[model samples]
Target: MSMSLSTLGALIDTDHMLRACCNNPKCRHYAKLDLEYLAVKLGRDHSSMRDDLVPKLKCSKCKSKNISLILSAKSTEGLGHT
Candidate 1:
């Protein structure tokens, strides 16, 4: 009637997971980097020095139009890291 610790951990991780641009507080989106896409645009794999705008047009959690045209490495964490 009870799940194992590993199963519980997996469930917890899945439930708290957030997509790349979700910008939620209860996920690891803040710690991840979209390195592949960033590399293509920058023409290099070194993402640290690449200074180009990553265009994104999506809705925020508040259902507001969120348009971002800034560096990809910029902090998108609205509610801080999870």
Candidate 2:
């Protein structure tokens, strides 16, 4: 897939996806959402703005405000490519 014009970045257009993990080490609840999915969920054009998503994010396990962001190697299409 080709990259969108969105500020979320060109990585979103690729097969690989991004992961938002719980910042709290104890909290295991993490949200594995793609930039596209996140954009729709947050009613935005893209997930480039971290501030916009941080307030809305919460650890399902511990409900912590602290969160971490991770870029996954696996894309929506498949792995071992990106």
Candidate 3:
């Protein structure tokens, strides 16, 4: 997939899917993030991946701010399942 015009350089240089995982030892919650939503919501502040996005994330289950990110190619349309 190609990068959407408004999404270029927002979260990443290319079109990709982002997944966030909780870093808490007892609560490892995982979730997929919508790049477009983040781009629109964050605007100019969404420049750097780790510097900007990481600080804004929290685990839905444990509400922990410690999170890790995973980047996957947008072209992998059916890879979410096992």
> Each candidate: how many clashes?
0, 2, 0
lDDT of 2 by residue, 20-46 (tens): 788777666777765676656755544
Best-to-worst ranking by TM-score: 3, 2, 1
lDDT of 1: 0.32
lDDT (0 to 1) per candidate:
0.32, 0.62, 0.71
Clashing pairs in 2: 15-75, 16-75
* lDDT (Cα, 0-100) at 31 in candidate 1: 28
Rate residue 44 of model 2 by lDDT.
51
Q: Across residues 1-82, which tens digit of lDDT does each residue of candidate 1 receive?
A: 7632122133232332223343333431222334444435543323232122223323334332322322221244455757
The lDDT of model 2 is 0.62
Alpha-carbon TM-score of each model against the true structure: 0.22, 0.56, 0.70
> Rank order by lDDT, top first?
3, 2, 1
Higher-ranked by lDDT: 1 or 3: 3
**Using TM-score as the measure, which candidate wins?**
3
